[model samples]
Target: MKISIITVCYNSEATIEKTLKSVESQSYPNVEYIVVDGNSKDNTVQLIQQYNSIITKWVSEPDKGLYDAMNKGIEMATGDLVGILNSDDTFYDEMVLQQVANFHKQNNIQASVGNITQHNEEGKTVRKYSAANWNPEKLRIGFMPAHPALFIKRELFDKYGKYALDFKIGADYELITRFFLKEKISWKYSEITTTAMLIGGVSSSGYESYKLITKEIAKALNRNNISFSYTKIFLRGFWKLVSFLKKK
Candidate 1:
């Protein structure tokens, strides 16, 4: 089965090369590697040009934001399965896509979710996020499998919908919640570390981000008509702290 991997980036020169090389080195051959750039002012486009041979398609232009660029990439995908890899993240190993393909071939599911390790600039592991214990009910608490580690069927976007452009930080959460909880799509969890994410993304930065995401998450649940309480959402922080401490 063909797999399409999309990397959405902007001004990621310092880290984009590693992300590019990781995709280029994947053992899976039938990969449609697409990169969408938000008209970066840095040499990010130049770096993308250097890997033109490996990248199936790339576009550098202005976009609304991260989710908008991701929507553009999803529109360009022709493979059966689609995945998003952020500019600051890399697959855990060369076999990740191959494993994803194998898992889907054997499982008869619509989507696959895997684990992810978050690391600091020093390449030290900060926390490990796993989907092994994830359930649709967890959406009420703003808990989800790592977005970057999720490989989903492309047609699901057409059937359910694409990322909601209305959200600033909770679009991914909203989309996943819509599929797994609201729509009840079939999915399986694989115990593979798919993405190694670098810290300092917009959502991982600080207190203001946490507050914004919590509010947007609440908005997402309400929009989907899913019953939830701020008490449950705020409790997710304690779970996250537990996960981090376990990693330590």
Candidate 2:
């Protein structure tokens, strides 16, 4: 199945080239690449034009924000499967999509979630590599594969609707919660499909943003009838660090 990979970007000249090259260099050539930029005031647009041959479509203008840009990408996707690989991130290798497509064909799941690894600004692998096995029970406390590692059949959005526009930082979490928890959609796990990321996006840049994430996670769990305490979340967060130590 052809996959549409959407990238949401804003003033990402330094990194957008890497993201675009990663998409273009893929061994699986059927990717329909769409990039939605929020009016980057830099050479990001220039770089995009340089690689215009491989990109199926691209736009650079002001957008509501990350989620809004992503919504636009989803609206533009014409492939059978949809996935997001943000401007700040790149594929682990050229064969990553080929691996994901194989797993998709082998499993009966509507969505696929994979592993990830974080890297420094210089692209040195830093940390990350968690075993996020999907299940309704595991999800109660708080469980999610890396957002960048997720690939859903395009029809899932056609059926479930797009992400909630109200959420600021946690819209994706809410979408996953609704799709996997609220509606009980089946998902498949990819042991090493995508890299778990840590490129310090807007969400990871400050304490206030993290506080917002905590509040949102609590709100999400409350809606799902799962009681999560700060301590519980802290332990889970610590394991996130511990995850880097265990080599698979």
Report, for all candidates in order, the number of backbone clashes. 0, 4
lDDT at residue 98 of model 2 (Cα atoms):
94
Q: What are the models' TM-scores?
A: 0.96, 0.89
Question: How many clashing pairs in candidate 1?
Answer: 0
Question: What residue pairs clash in candidate 2, if any at all?
Answer: 116-195, 116-196, 117-195, 117-196
Instruction: For model 1, state the Cα shift of residue 51 in Å.
Output: 0.5
CA lDDT, every prediction? 0.93, 0.80
Worst 10 residues of 2 by lDDT: 133-142
Error of 2 at 132 (Å): 4.5
Structure candidate 1, residue pairs in collision: none
lDDT string for model 2 (1-248, tens) is 89999998888898888788888889997899999989989898898999989899999888888899999999999998899998878888889999998898899998888877888877788766554655655555555667888899888898988877777887787788878887788887778557535468766667678678767766766665665575565455566557545744
Top-TM-score structure, candidate number:
1
Give the Å shift of residue 178 in candidate 1: 0.6
